[model samples]
Target: MIKHHEPLETAGPTVGAGAPAAGTAEAAPQDESEHGTLQKLKVMQFNIWLGGSEVEGGRAGIADTVATVEPDVVMLSESSPERVTNLLADLAERGLTYFDNKNPDDRAVLSRYPIIEHTSFPSWSKAVFSFGGTEIAAYSGHLEYRYYVTYLPRGYGGGTPPPLETSEYGWKKIPTGPITDADLIMRLNEASGRTKVTQTVLADAAEERSAGRLTLLAGDFNEPSHQDWDHRTQDLFDHHGTNVTWSTTKAIEDAGFCDSYREINPDPVLTPGFTWPSDNPGADISKLTWAPDADERDRIDFVFYYPDERLRLHDSLLVGPSGSIVRSKRVQEPGKDRFWCPTWTWPTDHKVVLSTFHIATR
Candidate 1:
């Protein structure tokens, strides 16, 4: 069954206070190794809405939510300096310190262990650190979103004209209703092009993998994956005239990365992990300057990795709210391992994906 980590209104005590010192760059104790033979790590992928600046409890809620997970590594998108500062301070107060961060104001990586090496791009960043004497590459990424194509006029935002004007929310002008097949094709092509940046980043990380090392890719792709939206689940999305093959995530998968959430919940029809429109108060896109259609949300955020024989997927935790009903039937079902349902407070519009892995390092 999928593990759902409940949201904490406040930071709790340090998770692994008695475990190995993070200063020594060793892997933390393995909770899954009942036989006490494996080492494990927890990674969290979160897109704190604009750094969770607009949340009711502000960055504190974001910090508290993250602290509750006690992740060894965190990949945050839409992060800001102020929010990161507040989050770090809150974690410190909880006796959980993450000393390393990249691009503290945007796509960033936070690690409790030391970041031995790091790399960056315009839209993504990666850090290579030691875990159980093996090098591990952890990437934080954020891809170009669909607003360029759907919210702005054609050629205005470097995106193609969308097929259907399903939602009149856009720039200065109202969109024409129910687009044509040709328009849909245009949108698909434009969307695919936007993913090239993320593809390159993932490819680079894949190539950098070496012996005694593993690679992890996590963050907000801002677009759904071709794997997630196939012929079977095309109806779930508004369709926008045609089932588009989202390229950003496809590229990562092509490079041999596994979507951590999907790896556990293989049936897309059953476990549709939607992480957008967080459906929160401040997350309403209608209030933005160029309001786009937040009506049809998708699972844009992810935690992906290069699967290794040495690594075992223990459990994936989805942290979000239970309400905010979507129109899809498959997503609304509530049961064990049925999509995601949260009983606690979700601070940001984007829910968090935390994947715990047990690595056999002997």
Candidate 2:
């Protein structure tokens, strides 16, 4: 049984979406003559539940998570001042550094390089993004990539975890409109639809003007892809980013962006391999909720790249190499919850995700 250092809070953003917020920083000049120019590197997204019933570090937990990813830049949501502030403080303590949101955890980013600009998109109500870093005229310092970290409202809330009902999953036929009833299913779908549109607008903007610079958006998108998020359940998000599960489950597939993990590891493997069932280490997951089914290990968290993608950001700090898992669990202070499973662990329920990269100009 893998022991955990308990702590949690809101179901925050996915891997890259909720690590740490980044702020403007001074750019460091590069030596063109020495190592020459470099190409743009990888971007990452994740959700750290924060301090809650499931996980419980609050801001302190977020701080420890930041160190784990070791990303060049990061975006996080559902995090608060205590969490963000504590993270910056922790970074400083560990010889690391970061910038924070003056207003709490609306959205933020942390980076290895200096941040040149940070702004929020109009589409995302509680979302913000960062597009700043050392930009050199040449390819080496070329900061041609921009990133967004977001968290949409959960389509289903206040209900006993939902049980899988059918096989349509992501394609659960959209209910006939004029939705006037207060049925839980209808209301949740409506909320999910709104979130879908919002994210689509944001993603479209990035994809529309991606001038050879890849635009990536990451988060615990309350709505999963038509295929993955739904599985045996109903597909609520029919219009998210580019293409969704339809492209995958259909006979004629239209995989919009490459699912990086699949590209690298062809044979799909249950991420986190073990330690998900809220009940047992590997219980009878068939009966759990679709949102977090123990057995169905789908990609709720992800890394997507536009056609403008450059050198891919190497993956694997989060799910370290075989026999070398880098724990994202944080050190606990006194007077905090101690349960480790089903709720209560460092930072948030979702694990802290990390991705690192350096500009490529060679």
Candidate 3:
């Protein structure tokens, strides 16, 4: 659905807000590139929830959603080559012929424009996005998202799990059981994997910038950000054990890449932007009947860009549902003031996030 949600956290300027907080790496470039007139690109970042085949509506739903959104470019995760082909074919029927194949296993980049190869970093694929005569380097990356403790089997947390009411307002803490660390060692190891990938991608994005190119990075990061889980939010999600300085996003920010969603919605407390679990209510977790912890969700998917004088945030939307599926769910708590749930017709278990940018050159 095309929503006209309120402009979130309007305390700062819409574009070129100001300098980064002390110690934070500057995400946007300081200078401008004299090239062309104002142009825009609507990019979508989606994780097709298990290869896009494990959803309620299946492949057709995946294609339909893409057609519905009609984003200029898409960065996908938990995806396969076959799924991308299906989506492209579907869009073609609508006279929207998107061409993209720089996908390896689980991540892919599908674009409406011609994609030129970028060889700076051998690990992740980079493409030249020709936007209104301006060439910007777009990096499509799917970082390692599996963390140890998070993936551990249930019993680790002890007793019954907490009541996690999923909605636009995000996870609401309910009185339940103790937040355990039965698999702390394993979870820590899993988190380290994310850290490794974060460092690698940052270095690559930096290389793209040094070459004098505007850069964009989109993907399923699998980890949360240090900014999102700070003092104001720690007490709310206290069940998480400790507020993690998730290295994947931290490295990206330190490397000077602006999180498109976060840039527009500055307050994590207000706009959590939770994407995982999709909380579809139709998800197939029957196999995990014994593992409630297995269903723990958060905002893991993202669309981030290297702030350029040419690229300015226009708007962003978190595509999903608008109510609670879990009954006896709390309604209006602070920070839980609103909820946007996925429609029963929605296919994937993760919400799709779209960010539009206005690129102008003087």
Candidate 4:
């Protein structure tokens, strides 16, 4: 079986005492044999929401994010070549090495360790590749971020979208109807396509399924639940994903992987740490305008940890809170005001997420 589903909930920030050391970088532990082994892996997955418009310059947001929680290995989504290049440059200044982010269409993996190898699995759509790997192939992205030309719209956020959920109680209550939410249904199917890519890679990794080498398939999967598609035409549209709830957790589980958070928390999903809203809340009045800790709802950013339990998972956490969306103040000085156009907030509608994994050869 796909490892009995362990329903889990979002684990809010760890209060003082049990919290991992903030703003500190410790060397990844080593094994007695002197072979490179991961001591601890704090893998984090986050979607910078189309970029990082919620904050000032997504650069600042990215830097601040890394400095805040400080994960050793991070898998970020929705990034572009420009943004990734900028992030790499900025991260380097801070003594952090961003491995294998020099690509297009976002979906990047910024690691503190050296990347061994990198490859991309071009999809049938010809628009986006389903998989990308590096020399190490340990922390590789086996699944594609999906951009089916036949199904996807001409541009990002284009084409027929899912119906805006209108609930009798509120946005909290996932609308249940005879017809599936149009856009949600489409994204859900797109999700399966991504999973197909993931399974194919995992099947290959099965040969070297030995410990130490970890293949993490993570990032924002714009789909929800492996069950519960009771919406307009959910049976027709939601299709195979109809039975699943509004959760990517279920989708990854379907790919023969385990939810990293669930592996630790055992709740149904990430509650307080919903990354979809960019922590600043979105157009959803009920869910938007995140208030430090009050805004508690659902999470769309999912992390699927392939059955690699050897890399000492410790302090494995999702370090994210809302980021600052500071509107640029009009500073009329020597063309410098708009000279350095904040390359972050103007980029997109999501906040950046940072995570680290401490690898040790124990």
Q: 168 in model 1: Cα distance from truth in Å?
A: 11
- Name the runs in model 1 displaced over 4 angstroms: 1-37, 146-175, 180-193, 281-295, 325-345
lDDT (C-alpha, whole model) for all candidates:
0.61, 0.33, 0.56, 0.41
**Winning candidate number (lDDT):** 1
Query: Mind giving the per-residue lDDT tens digits that candidate 3 earns over 1-362?
Result: 21221222212122223211111111222334464565556778887776555655656556656665556778877776777777777666645568775565667777777777643232255667665556677766666542323322211321212231111111223234334443442345343466565566677667767877678888776556667756666545332444555566777888788888888778887777666555454554442122343334456678888887777887665666432122223112234212323332556766777787767643
Best by TM-score: 1
Candidate 2 TM-score over all chains jointly? 0.51
Q: For model 3, which pairs clash?
A: 148-187, 149-187, 168-339, 168-340, 321-340, 321-341, 321-342, 322-340, 322-341, 323-341
TM-score, per-candidate, Cα-based: 0.77, 0.51, 0.73, 0.59
User: Which rank order by TM-score, best down to worst?
Assistant: 1, 3, 4, 2
Evaluate model 1: give its TM-score. Answer: 0.77
Model 4: worst 10 consecutive residues (lDDT sum): 331-340
- Superior candidate under TM-score, 2 versus 3: 3
lDDT of 1 by residue, 1-362 (tens): 01233333211122222221222236656554433446768788888777656655646666666655667889988886666787787777756678555564478888877888887876788888776665688889877654444322221232333453422343333334433243544455455455667766766776777544788889887666666656667555454434556666776788888888888767666666666655554444343223243234557788988888767777664666533334311133242332233333456777678787887654
Error of 3 at 337 (Å): 9.3
Candidate 3 at 148: error in angstroms? 4.6
